[model samples]
Target chain A: MAWYFSGDKAVYLQIMEEIQLRIISGFYPLGTRIPSVRDLAEEARVNPNTMQKALTELERSELVVSQRTAGKFVTCDEKRVTEIRERMSSECMEEFLSRMKKLGFTEKEASEKIGQHCAKNETDPRN
Target chain B: MNEILVCSDLCKNYGQKTALSHLELTLERGKIIGLLGPNGSGKTTLIKLIAGLLVPTYGSLTVGGNRIGVETKKIVSYLPERTYIPEWMKVKDILDFFEDFYSDFSRDRAVEMLTSLNIAVGDKIKTMSKGTKEKVQLILVMSREAELYLLDEPIAGVDPAARDYILRTIITNYNENASIIISTHLITDIEPVLDDVVMIQNGTLRIHASVDEIREKNQMSVDALFREVFRC
Candidate 1:
């Protein structure tokens, strides 16, 4: 379905990211049962084995846990989800700072520029 | 789970013109392999050998642990590039023939696909458009639930909507234990669905790797890599 793929990155990694996004975005609410491997694979148009691997990764990261006889569930821990969200925001800021630095802007100049840019644009998509 | 297909030093020759040479590879279950090459890169020859239509000159090939013969043919469902069914037969007639010939064929699945595509069961094959004929052939092949699906140019000469339909049908119908190999020149259209890619040049294997690994190593899509590698 091309829902979890951008045709550039690894499919399983993308699947992992997508599931994580779902957890943090509350599409998969805390402690809710996630889709089975076969359903997720069918939805993502990937092999079930690939889906299994991605789910394994999620389990390893403690974002999801598997119960005996039951299915995988998103962790009920909201603190962990917030931690991931903050980590992603920090990474996004690092990307912005490095990009502005490459354009010959100092850190303070970059910060001031961001402030001025955000003040000028009512709803900056980039911002 | 056993390997779906294995080839060892596989070679084929037509009176000194080599069609395939030293083709050693192994395919596992639950994979969607994309067999890609230019016009004369032995793509069809490899597919034909697996389909049991052609014999290799000096090598061995096996499918589902059986040699390329009746048993292998029974488990391997092939869709050749050109139309192979009779023109006069109705679509329903073809479904019945497939069901009779292959024990794995699901008549209900075929009928459901035809109905969903707005294709009538009583419609004659020759009367339908080329696109409809192709869709019918694809539906017949896919309904079999074979261990291995060898599709040769299944999406060629079709509209985008039809292409999407064909891809979706393939993804939904195939089971995890079976594998599918799609041989096509339309790389971009089938790139997302491929798990592995096998590319040959001048009757020799050039590249065989997983799709994710190729993207990670080359930093480009499979289609772009094909264009660069086969550039004149």
Candidate 2:
């Protein structure tokens, strides 16, 4: 899975967003062992402490679990992960739809466009 | 308990140039204080004096009714503007060093955080980038359960995205009863979290008041007032 950093926000929050994206995209499957903080910090070119803050935020949301000697791993609870994923997706979709409507797109038109985009992606050889 | 910080006629000088001139201020507990000033305005000097890193040329600075010394140092967790950690040490080693020196440091919490960030304990600091190094420094300072936190330009060098995380960590991790004094010129970025502000100009106290009072009295953001006051 690819890692992404965002501008105009906290690094820790961006890190959390990236992790959430991975979880949602199924790159980090349920029960998968996540990299250590130092490893992630090195890869992301962020301070380990900043990385730690992101992880703490994730753990607070119950998206990841930590064990003393074994290190941190993605939460194994499929139902919880699904719930989080759906909730985030719905929130994003709502925001996107509202923005599109504000920009003069009708609800039906927005839906049709999204459907076409998804269908095209599904049939594309790149998929 | 009643007074978090007390500085009376604090003065500092470098040769003929005076950095701080008879500055007196009192800081109370459970407040987030912004130490604001232009470049070379003695913001760092005042913080260093209060932190016990630099001695005053005149007057006395005290915390919890004690003079600035080793005793006061124990309760203060300081994050300097520049890198303090050696580049050769591993992340784990840094944690160990903090654990050994600072009794209030939380090693478990630090490790757990690192794990979530995907940072390995064994990785050397030399391999990490500058932004990451700053984050590591911030984490160590934040993890301490100290009574006073002196942060010198905590978000000065980082990208905008990382600035939010640093601010968030400061908001979330700080001790409720402790006082935090942050020195910065990035006034707009930190204006939301500040409870009180102390502004300096030419090594003298210019503005010292609660954020609400300043906003109400001036009808402008701290950043705006800062620009107006220190207009070049």
Candidate 3:
């Protein structure tokens, strides 16, 4: 999975968002071993403590479990991932639809535009 | 629990003028306090006095039930507004000094932090740029497992990117049982993490309350209240 780092928000929140995205994307599949805190911090160019906070949050959410000597690993429960994906996707779609409506696009027009864009990207060799 | 720190009618005069005038404050433990004020608002002076860096002109101050002295300094780790480390020393040398003086200093943690920042231990402070030196100083201050951390303008000089790192370091390094008093005019950057706030204006304590209490009472964010209170 590709690591995304941004300075726009709190590091811990950003890390959480990125990890959730990865889980949704199937890059970090259920029961996968996530990188060590040190490695992840180095990759993200953040302090390990920031990474730890993110991991702790993930543990709190029950999406990941930490072992004593062995590092943190994703829970082998696909139900949790599915729940998170559905919740996040619905929220994002609602936001997107609201913005489109604000920009004077009707529901059908917005859906048609999105479909055309996706179709073009699928067919285009450069894409 | 009520009195993590107590200063009774404290006064500090810098020659002709008074920096602090009969200041009285009681800081409780386990709270993240924001010491808010403008420049020359006696914020730094008050912090210095409590840190035992400067002696009070009149009254007495106690930290963790003991008077401010060598013992108090041991429990309090302070980060001054400006770079306080000698410019000639290496990063590793500063670590050694901290290790020598402060029993709570975590050398391994400091070294790990330097590595994470891609800062070499052997590099001299003179060779690094000003911003990097400031980060190194912050890392050192935060690595300590002190009871009271007085961070004076920790984010003032750094760039926006570095500010996040600085805040993250504080969040990560702070011991839960300890109290952190961050003195700064930059309210927006730190308003989210502050558990309590001590608003000081013109050498007087204006307000002191938990973040939740302040929000509940004012129905506004601390940043908004700061602007309103410190408005000219």
Candidate 4:
């Protein structure tokens, strides 16, 4: 997948966010090895040192584990993955609600609008 | 602590005009440094000094801990802003010349890069387009296993596709034991590829900081910062 940077934040931080998103979305499946720093840098059009820094941060957060000669793999811990997914979901919801609030909608009103939109889009939707 | 290049009180002059004045700079190994400035801000003069093409009027500069001379020249690979190949020479002839001139020149790496770009060995310099000639020059420079790479305006005057190719070549060829200094005014295009930026203004060093640190402090891209710093 092609990566686009916003240029306002540090490139390494943005790389970390993108890699985290890939892991949560299963684009880089759990327990699967990820691309090397050089390959990822080429794909993202960034410096390899920046890519290495991002991956090192990922390792610190326990989202990835490096096995020396075997390279790095996405965390196989289902609990940790679910926790990150929940955190991401809350962040998206909060951002959506905040934007809606700016347009004169309350939190409840925003929730109802999202439910209606999901009902229209998904074949089987919860009430 | 492994600094590959060091310059102390470096100054250069052209007749009565000062091109660079008392420039003190140290470059560590394995970094991609952006030598940035506006038109005639002494970027070219500083690079020429490092490349040993021009002598500094004052102070001292060293490459790989040795003074700029035959020993340092053997380890420093440079690409000037202009293409220097004779028009009648074929690609193979140029490759042969470099291979014979520098002990660290890699013929295999040069051939592989040329083949990948579809640059035939038999193609004469006169037959290639301007962009192609620049690419050939870059390929020849990067094919060396040198301690330092001084690329003067390597990405200027090229299409976006060609720019991407050049950046990729630089990224992939980068070794931990060497460093690359890419001099250009196109900050936005090469900002992400650079580890640090050395900004020069009015024949003096303005700022020399890491790319991420610049973004974090200014809350903007290096290109935007450059515009603000050099605003007319």
Candidate achieving the largest TM-score: 4
Overall local distance difference test of candidate 1: 0.88
Looking at model 1, the pairs that clash are none
Q: Distance from true position, residue A38, model 4, in Å? A: 1.0
Quote model 4's TM-score: 0.96
lDDT, candidate 1, B51-165, per-residue tens: 9999999889999888989899899999998888898899878988998899999999999999999999999988888888888889999999799999999999999988888
Candidate-wise lDDT, in order: 0.88, 0.84, 0.82, 0.92
List, in order, the clash count of every candidate structure: 0, 19, 0, 0
lDDT of 1 by residue, A1-127 (tens): 5563665677788888888888988999999999988778667766666678889998998899999789999998889889988987888899999999999999999999999887879576665
Measured by DockQ, the strongest candidate is 4
Ranking under TM-score, best-scoring first? Answer: 4, 1, 3, 2
Query: What ranking emerges by DockQ with the best candidate at the front?
Result: 4, 1, 3, 2
- lDDT head-to-head 3 vs 4, winner: 4
| DockQ head-to-head 1 vs 2, winner | 1
Residue A81, candidate 3: C-alpha displacement in angstroms: 1.2
Tens-place lDDT per residue, model 3, B130-192, is 789889988998889888999999999789888878877776675657888999888777765
The list of candidate 2 runs beyond 4 A from truth reads A1-127
Give lDDT: candidate 2, residue B91: 96
Task: Give residue A95's error in model 2 in angstroms.
Answer: 26
**lDDT for each residue of candidate 2 in B6-41, tens digit (9 for 90 to 100):** 989989998899999999899998777999999999
RMSD of each: 2.7, 9.6, 5.4, 2.1
Q: What is the TM-score of each candidate against the true structure?
A: 0.90, 0.65, 0.68, 0.96
lDDT score of residue A104 within candidate 3: 100
- The DockQ values of the predictions, listed in order, are 0.45, 0.03, 0.08, 0.73
